[model samples]
Target: MTHRFVFPTLALALLLAGCTSLPAIDPAALPATPAAFKETDPRWTAIAPAEAQPRGEWWKAFADARLAELVERAGRDNASVQVAAARLAQARALLRDAQASQSPQIGLNAGALRQAEPGAGGRGATLVSAGAALSYEVDLFGRLSRASEAASLDARSREALLQSTRLLVQADVAQTYLALRAIDTERAIVGDTVEAYRNTLRLTERRVQAGDIAELDAARARSDLASTEAEAFALERQRAQLEHALAVLVGEPASGFSVAVAADTPPLPQVPAGVPSTVLARRPDVAAAMSQLQAARARVGVAQAAWFPNLSLTATGGVASPEVSDLFKWSARTWGIGALMSLPLLDGGRREAGVQSARADFDAALASYREQVLVAFKDVEDELAALRLLEDQSQAQARAVDSAARATALSASRYRNGLVSQLELLDAQRSELRNRRQAVQVKAAQQQATVGLIRALGGGWS
Candidate 1:
């Protein structure tokens, strides 16, 4: 009896000794990050990245009541966000299923059978049966544990991806709506210029009738008015297109949805840029990448476990009788118990291939995780650069608009006093309109860049 237990005990010890745990993944293994941003404005304060935390109501910082309302609506109604939520739910369910495998399974079964008895001259007899069965895998090699860990990690990955999707949709809504407002502002400018040109045409026509101005002056005024009106129409068309895009983003049909023409761009928010490496912790996409890498590592452990042994226990208890009423009799009681141990002694290299494949998958996940971190840094840098350069452009454009406005006023006065030709006055008017439009466009760009920076910083500064 002692010898009989000795062999199994020695085998168990060998199996335990041979088992391998998953490799540890370190965030520090990724490429080193820069301490400070290369292109940052003096207005932005840089602090070391803090512990990762949830983002706040960052959009509300812009102080636009309408934009705040629209962002809330988009978060609640966006189709892409709904899809991501569904996927996250599915991953959670799958993780639960993996966890259930760790527990013993019990089932009840019932059956009736008719068969000929060999010793009873081929007489047919009906037998009735009922039973309770139990089964459980003894996870001796950690296969089930690793599988459950991988599933749990996968669920976490999905959760992070859902966060990423929500951030993307909200940012897109902000940028699109801001662009529409900029178009409205431009349309208003053109409409005002068109009215001024129309009045100039009427004045020129009256002067021509009184023999005080040439007919060519009236023709030039009419031409300018018509051109300005055309520009206003084009701006209106662009506004319509942007409104349609906003409708789709909010999960509504464009035909049934509308946003009133917004004439004012919201003041840009002053979002500070945190330490450059902090993006790895701040961005949900980066978190998802790391989660996937961890899951892949768990899968590698599961694949390695396949080379070891598996143990299982099963039991059944039942009663059978020719008559249904006798099924529960004391004399009809039956029971059984069993233990099974299986170890793969030989295979056509299938297990080895599985192990190799799992390792390769892990390697791929690691590389992808590294790439995601790099891309996150690039996103922040791109937005920072855009905001910085656009600010400089906006300041210069303001000066240009001021100069153009002064020139247009002086030219108009000169034309009325017969100091300049109609062509020269019209040219001044066109220059003023162009400069003002450019200024508004630059302001709109600065606003768009601010939103982009907020998004690139993972929706908020820490």
Candidate 2:
């Protein structure tokens, strides 16, 4: 009679002990966000959090068809994006496995045995049994629940990382394609300069033959033509390298892939700036970090719950008989049900170590999350500042190019009229070419900075 009461009393004790709740996590421990970014534009307006929203066709804002196509191709085929997607799939599968642990496990069992009875000497008997068993953990200390939550958060983190990878690939494709276009513009400028030098060389050679100018002037003109041609070749090499990089981004063989030289680079698109909080919420890296932190927090609870008693309920039903004919009889039926409560009395400090390790992971994840937020803010500020300064630089470069062009035209006419020497005409020509190339370079910087701003802002303002 005393033994009959033991199981119920033990179960009651375990249930009461499980009433101990996990400690609450403080949200205030995270870094505080300001209402606006330090460099937020006044024209910027409040927008909804866009992390969950699709950044559909953000590259189209540049109004370049080829760029949009390349970005879309990179999004579909980039190796980094594919790897992140595979990781996300694995995380989801692990989440399903964790959820399965919370559900009852059912299994079928069957066995056949042949054994000799000691009293029967040489006689052998056959026993056959078939059964179904059900087992379930009671989750008395919320360990299973917390484990599932952690798995779910891990899946979310992987998903956010995948989005971040896609965004990165898109930005890379746009920047590379824009760079190639800029090289094309510079190449055109150099090609024109080379032709102009060739013309100057021919005029100098004719004047030298007629005894109007010395051989020295023709030698200088020849040197200028060769150097300008060499510069054009350098631009060609850079354009080829950029094309190869773009091909790799789109998952194509570099040897066979090429982007046609475009006559014009795309105009820089205006990217709006919103509050820092909204930008943080929209960035996938920040989302991934937050998920990691939450997952770590859940794991901490799971580790703490490990110190509590675990309760499991099990049931089995089967039929057993000495003969096959008797196996189906009602008298051969057998059924059993049991409840178990287990608590570790000694573990050589393993439980305490697990709790400590989990807490440490939580702390590390918290730090990582904070760092990611700070970096995200820094990226936005850096790009904003770059675009602002690059715009002013581009305008100033344009003025310089115009002034150089006028000086070169005047010097060329004076040289033809014998009012200026060949060296003066060559100097003005060199100045014009340098200023024009600089203008193209500044324009390219502006385009790249625009793309950087879009990427830093988490894809698009929309």
Candidate 3:
């Protein structure tokens, strides 16, 4: 008995000694990061990235009640977000399945067999057997543990992706709603311009009837009025389309959903004055990529473990008897215990191929993680640059709108007193309308850029 135990214990010691540690990527080898962002504003303060934390209702900072409501609805009902949530759940379940492999398995079975007794000259006998079996595979090489770790990381990646989806949906809804509101304000401006053109046409017609102006002046005035009306109609068409798009974003049918026309657009949300360059790490997409890279690294360990032998311990106990009534008797009791060790000597290079495949997957994941980090930095820079440039452009456009409005007023007074031609008056009116429309568009762009920056910063700076 002592010799039997000694051999098994010696074999177990050898297997334990051969266990390998999982491979890990060296942090020093990863892509270098900047200490500060090029576009960092003076008002920004340095803070660490906290992408794993909950991002509350960031849209409320805009102070737009309708926009806040719409964002909430999209978070709850958006199809993409729902799909991501389902995938996260699946990944978690897979992690549990992988973990189950590390635990012993138990099974109970019962059966009745009818056969002839070999030495009894074809005498028939009935045998009843019941048994309980337990088996456990020792994780001597860490294969099962690495597999579980990979599955856990996969679940983490899915969870981050779900957060990314929710943020995307919220930002999209806010931008679309704001765009629709800008269109409403623009339409109102065009409507006012159309009325002004009509009044100009009426004045020109009166002068022509009195022989104070040429008939060509009256025709020119009429043409200007018609052109302004066409512009107003075009704005109406654009507004309709924007409204339809907003309806779909809020998870409503285009035919059944509508937003009330409002001349007021949502105010731009304020950006934190001092944002740290490390904020890029808070991006959900980047986090997902990092998780995927870790998972791939763990799978490499699992593949490398395939070259080691697997040891399983099994035990069974039960009773068997030819008579059903005697199956459970102590005299008929039977039991067995065994151990198995499988080591494949030749497999046509299948294990090597598995290791190579796992290594390649790790390389791909590493590259993807690096790319995601770069993209996060790029997104923040793009929106920051857009906001800065658009602010200057909007201010310049505002000055142009004011000057054009004054010019239109002066030209109209001069045309009435015969100091200016109808052509000059029409030119001034067109300039005013164009500048006003451009101002509205610039304002919309600024608001959209604010939304983009918020999204790029992982939903909100806080």
Candidate 4:
């Protein structure tokens, strides 16, 4: 009767081991790419190559040595990039650990003890035993395989995320540098305007004393001078703030770092355009999201494998005797091997709940991946439209600045020759200032938009 029961139990274990269920998944079942790109302008319709560039040196296109150096430093020292890199290393270590589990684990056992008898004639003996034991779980249902797959995908995802963080840091440094340059330009303009206004105020006061102009003109000149001074103060404040921000972005104390402005404006780099669909593969975030989705899908397989039986084989061998010399004798040899199996006959629906939970997580991952793709497309389109409009506006602003300069020159000549009132000269002066300020603003906008385009294109970083 005992043999019959043993045979039935073995048969049940074998039957349960073959009961694993894995769902089928096809990569082709993923959603189609959305039609989000619009027709490009004829002048800007040419697409650039989408080949990856050297890692973390993408700012060389600007031809600014200082900017390049700053980017290099930030990439190496930035806290956020360091954190991402650490996470990537951790994920790789975890993958190694998971892969190691596929093989058998062996360990050594050794111990020695001494005890004295309770009688007056005390005696002690040293006990020394050494052996190696091994335990290995049979992955008959591919549970270990699926788990390793998930771990590898997670490692790849972390690597992609690190790349994404590096790109962001590089872009930020470049944008902040451009902003600092723009503020410096504005400061110069404001300084010259203030000087001109002060001269105008002094001349107006002289003309009033000479009875050539009314006191009202002097008051207006003073007001204009005051306004220009106020603008200069504001620009100074802005420059200081930008300086502080740039210092922090580069991982330095704000007070210890300062940026020197070049006399020439920084030229915008040429951005290569690509198809919207290509961005899905090039953007690090998008790639990371897809990897995460793959990992979650693999986890579904892992969860399903849990519903079947688990098989483990263990073996232990050692020599034991009351005397140390007798331990190696033939009579002291002892060894045993056994196979263990566990099947979930009834769990009050816990195994089913695990399957459902895994499915829900898989569904959420898919949704997140889709959303990332959509947002990536949207970002590219928005940058495209912005670049187009800003280019046109910049040209128009250049023409307006020219026209205002000519008008200012003519009005000043008329005032010197007594052909026009000082009020007319003042109006032209105000108009010229407004036009120049607007021109500076337009230039800044163009540079900023170009930077945005580079970022949207993943900034030539891989």
lDDT by residue for model 3 over 1-462, one digit each (tens)? Answer: 966965676586467546655567766656676666677754432344456876677898889988888888888887788899999999999999999999999999898999998999999889899999999999987889999999999999999999899999999998888898998989888887787677778777888898998999889878878887898888788878888877777788989988899997777776767654445556789889989999999999899888877889999999999888898899989899998877676999998899899999998998898788778878888998999899899889999999999999999899999998875786788689889988999999999999899899887766
Model 2 lDDT per residue over 266-376, tens place? 887775544334444577888899899889989998998877778899999999998888888999999999988787879999989998999999888988987887787
Ranking by TM-score: 2, 3, 1, 4
Every candidate's lDDT: 0.82, 0.84, 0.84, 0.77
Error of 4 at 390 (Å): 0.3
lDDT of 1 by residue, 1-462 (tens): 966865686487466637666767765767566665667633333333332467887788878888788888888999999999999999999999999999999999999999998899999999999999999998877789999999999999998889889889989988998899889888887876886687678778988999997899888888878887888888888899999999988889999989887677778777554434444356788888888998999999899888777778999999989999999998888899988767776899988999899988998999898898788778877988898898789889989999998998999899899999765776787788888889889988988887887787778664
Model 1: how far is 90 from its true place, Å? 0.6
2 or 4, which is superior by TM-score? 2
TM-score (all chains, Cα) for each model:
0.87, 0.89, 0.88, 0.86
**How many backbone clashes can be found in candidate 3?**
6
RMSD of 3: 3.5
lDDT of 1 at 172: 91
The 10 consecutive residues of candidate 4 with the worst lDDT sum are: 42-51
Residue-level error in angstroms, candidate 4, position 286? 0.5
Best lDDT among the predictions, by candidate number:
3
Across residues 251-308, which tens digit of lDDT does each residue of candidate 4 receive? 8998898888654567776555443434334577877888888899888888887776
